[model samples]
Target: MESAFSGHIYRQNGQGVTSILSRRVEGRLMWKQRIIGLHLRSKIDHSYLSQSQHADTKGKSVETALHSLVGHIEKANQYGDFTMVAFMDIEGAFNNVDPMADVEAL
Candidate 1:
């Protein structure tokens, strides 16, 4: 995904065009590098989690706890098979996900 543009002029009259071209090239390179890094990190994280015995046990425990909690809630609220559900949304959730910025700040 890396993109770059270069222009050579016989004279110095095309400074504006050169500047714009370099900026665009650099921007594309930055985006491509970011995407590659993200993909690599994701793959590494998935590998680590998949190979970890502790993660598997933790996941099972979490699922069991959630099932127990739901069962308890259902028993406590016996309304003839009718149940209620609540959902909440947080605004600017993605805006808070600056992983690099957070690492740099830390």
Candidate 2:
């Protein structure tokens, strides 16, 4: 079978070898990305960093963050305390980084 990503032909043994190989490649890529993400996130000083790529982190997505924020607001309202919120979009902030530099930094 021909691999769509690599454009290389792979031998099959009637056991979905192509599918297995593709999944293996994807797993390795995810692992590498996770390692790089962890290394970069370590430099952040904020204790509330909730990047979803980390294996141990939960409630790291925007939906979960918003849910937590709403929970906080509810708690503050119940206690008659002032609540403040600020949201910033840092999208594409790391899109310009060089892949080679990241590998070398690791």
Candidate 3:
């Protein structure tokens, strides 16, 4: 069986609103996740990004990425062979694919 997570909530004094969706992992899971995070971080390809991908590093926001992408597209258009630029964000798409849907609908 897999481990489960617990949710935590916190709020300030005199405030009626509370923060939800905060997770506090157990001790065992925390250690396990740390080890996994270290391994994954080490395996990242530092050279996979080219000079054109200026905002593709860690901690980059979507706004910065859009700025970089727009600049690159504009530069490419000057060559007279550019058609269109397609963008896809596939990070969390797997969860939203709805795998439980009826297969026959395909």
Candidate 4:
């Protein structure tokens, strides 16, 4: 169920152009992302990221999240505290990205 972009570039004239990237360029981009992920992981706390988003975090699923939530809810109930949860579905969350900004930040 992995979704990937087909590297298609669209023009103002409504023409679609397929951009083919060489393996070398693709590998370099992947390596850069992996390095960035490693650096971020070292600087940030692991708990701040969703388990599935990182590489080192394995054997974690939605069930694990639910179990943790239920345990916290039970503890809160024992202490007479209220628990609330919010869910958000954002469409096209990753569809827009400025590559120049990312390169500059790096």
Candidate 5:
């Protein structure tokens, strides 16, 4: 098993202003003929930290969420059973995600 953490910077505005920061930590395990990969991300949450009283609150929330997700993935990796394969593909991971629509009468 191997794990790595990486940081990335992106320019949000057209004027080359880069204000947002993000990071990702990935873990992988190779067994026989297959590999299992897990990715965790850190993103800036502006909603909870905009006000003076809420400063640092967003960081705490994101940290907790990432911790919980990583724990769950670790548990699954320890208990899940599977056979080794030569190839794997993640289909419709990003493009298929849809936001919930309010279809009822408003």
Candidate 6:
């Protein structure tokens, strides 16, 4: 079955208008996504690659990141040490994933 999609433009705060890709994603693609999402979450939740609260499980979000940062800063300050933060630019990071490699990993 073919489903129609309605694209809309919306403005955020004072930002200029942005086009949003609206569509009814369903069928096999949706099911695959749901399954993969759950698997990814499970693998990430208990992995060392995930931070204390940055783990992708429930109740973890920006607030979690903020709390972790605050805790680190507090601990460092208490020890009379300086803390430095470095942010990485990961725009289009997904482009680095190779399709065949992804299939192999899956």
Spell out the clash pairs found in candidate 5.
none
Clashing pairs in 3: none
TM-score-best of 1 and 5: 1
Which TM-score value belongs to model 4?
0.39
Best by TM-score: 6
Give the poorly placed runs of model 4, Cα more than 4 Å off: 1-57, 99-106
TM-score of each model, paired residue for residue: 0.28, 0.42, 0.37, 0.39, 0.22, 0.51
lDDT of 2 at 54: 37
Residues 18-57, model 4: lDDT tens digits: 3345545678877876776576446556677664352355
Residue-level error in angstroms, candidate 3, position 24: 4.1
**Tens-place lDDT digits, model 1, residues 13-71:** 54533555556668997786677556545544354453223322435565675576588
CA lDDT, candidate 4, residue 38:
71
Alpha-carbon runs more than 4 Å astray in model 6: 1-35, 42-55, 95-100
Write the residue-wise lDDT of candidate 2 on 31-61 in tens digits.
8777877876565455554452333354366
Candidate 1: 10-residue stretch with minimal lDDT: 50-59
RMSD of 6: 6.4
Q: In candidate 5, what are the lDDT values of residues 1-106, reduced to their tens digit?
A: 5546345556667776563433222212123112111111123334534343321353456557556556766777788944332433468653343322211211
Superior by TM-score: candidate 1 or candidate 3: 3
The weakest ten consecutive residues by lDDT in model 2 span 50-59
Cα distance off (Å), candidate 6, residue 91: 1.2
lDDT for model 3 comes to 0.58
- Candidate 1 wrongly placed segments (more than 4 Å): 1-18, 46-106
Error of 1 at 64 (Å): 33
lDDT tens digits, residues 15-71, model 6?
665444332233555576667667655554264454464535577787878888999
* Candidate 5 residue runs with Cα over 4 Å from true position: 1-60, 81-106
